[model samples]
Target: MRVLVAEDEQDLADLVATGLRRHAMAVDVVYDGTAASERLAVHDYDVLVLDRDLPGVHGDQICQDLVGVGARTRILMLTAAASVPERVAGLGLGADDYLPKPFDYSELVARVQALGRRSQAPVPPTLRRHGIVMDTQRLQVTRDGRFLRLSLKEYAVLEVLMRADGAVVSAERLLESAWDEHTDPFTTVVRVIISRLRAKLGDPPCVHTVPGAGYVL
Candidate 1:
């Protein structure tokens, strides 16, 4: 999963990113709300960890803008203000969850996971197809009861395809959903990952390339 973290505190941002990365989640950290808004507009992230006070734009405004634009990324607002009214305001502005400053890192991680689970597009928590089973919570993929070793990007690609099931997912859609903003779509990165996945999946070819279209599983 990918998460975008926007915080004015350099140390806190790095700390949060590092902790999430340890759990195999890809993270992008930005120091201001303007950059946060820009990143949100271009990339697809499972969750947005936003600080309420930020440079250029307030986090609440950014969250509101994202919701107004119909962005589905779940928002977890962080602020020093711990009042009930403050939390309510954040939620009213489209944040899915709110955490005050000096909170526990474990709580933050749990909240992020909960928001991601809630934001998913009505798919079951665990997805299974073509003898392949994916456990989103465990971040594990298994085929025919055997584990499959995959790189982070490869796992991300397979997760996207599996979530879509038999639907034909376009290249642009996969790029937007699976890759960060820095990844170049023109490059054969997705193709390479798909090739590796196909080799690992073996005989039945769980992922099928549709000429002039995209891929389906």
Candidate 2:
């Protein structure tokens, strides 16, 4: 999933971004609300982990703007204020969920994952195709019951393809879904990752290229 974390606390933002990346999410971090707004305008994020007390542009205004446009991105508002009224107010501003500061990292991850599922088409926690089984909840993958150890990027790319359900997925689409904004648009990383995935998946290849079209599984 792709996420935007808007937090004024630079340290906390970095930590959250790193943690989310470990979960195979493409995350972009912004320490101020202005940058957050810019990224939000440019990227098609699945979830927005927004801080209420952001600088440059208050998070409340950001939430209001997104709501005004009926954006599809799910928002999880964060704040140091833990009162019931505070949460209610945050949710009232159109956030899909509210999470207080200093919250459990696991809970944050779970909430993000839940919101991501809501943002996209309904997909089961587990996906299976062509003898390949992917358990997203456990972050596990296996081919014909044989466990496959893959890098996070490899797993993320594969997840996009598996979710396609045998339909063609263009390389640009794959890059957009699996990579953050920092990735070079001209990079061959997608092709490299696909080659690596094929090698790891082994025999009776599942991922196939469609000449100029893209790739299919």
Candidate 3:
């Protein structure tokens, strides 16, 4: 999944981006709300990790703007304020979830994944196709009761395809939805990842190449 991280602290932003990337998610880090808004406008993100305090634009306004513009990206607000009223205010501004400062990285990851799952179009948590079972929450994949080991990127690609089920997803769509904003659109990263996933999945003709289009699972 692709995520936009809007945080003022450079070090913290980098750390969050690195951790999300390690989980096979494409993440773009922006230091302030202006850059965050621009990034949100230009790219499709599964989730937005926004800090409440920001230069140019506060995170609340950012969330409100996104909702007003009908952007489907889920918002997870991060703030130093931990009061109940503060959390309620963030949620009222259109944030889907909220995380206070000095939070656990694992919890952040979990929340992001939960937001992603929530953003999906009303699909069950367990996505199954062609004998492959993917547990979105557990981040586990199994084929016919056998566990399948996948790298982060591979797993992400499969997840996207599985979510689409029998529908064809173009490469450009995949790049937009599954890759970080900073990733070059012209690159063959999606193709490479799909190839690796096909190899790992043992080629049951599940992921079909659509010639001039993209792939379907």
Q: What is each predicted model's overall lDDT from 0 to 1? A: 0.85, 0.94, 0.88
Off by over 4 Å in 2: none
Model 3, position 133, has a per-residue lDDT of: 93
Name the best candidate (by TM-score).
2
RMSD of each: 2.1, 0.9, 1.5
lDDT of 3 by residue, 121-171 (tens): 888988989999998777799987889899877888898898887899999
lDDT by residue (145-191, candidate 2, tens digit) is 99999999999999999999989999999888899999998999999
* Model 2 clashes, total count: 0
What is candidate 1's lDDT per residue for 104-138, written digit by digit as tens? 99899888978877777777878999999988777
Q: Could you tell me every candidate's TM-score relative to the true structure? A: 0.89, 0.98, 0.93
Q: Provide the lowest-lDDT 10-residue window in model 3.
A: 198-207
Error of 1 at 92 (Å): 2.6
- The candidate with the higher TM-score, 1 or 3, is 3
For lDDT, candidate 1 versus 3, the one ahead is 3
Q: Rank the candidates by TM-score, best first.
A: 2, 3, 1
Q: What's the count of clashing pairs in each model shown? A: 0, 0, 0
Error of 2 at 52 (Å): 0.8
TM-score of model 3 vs. true structure:
0.93
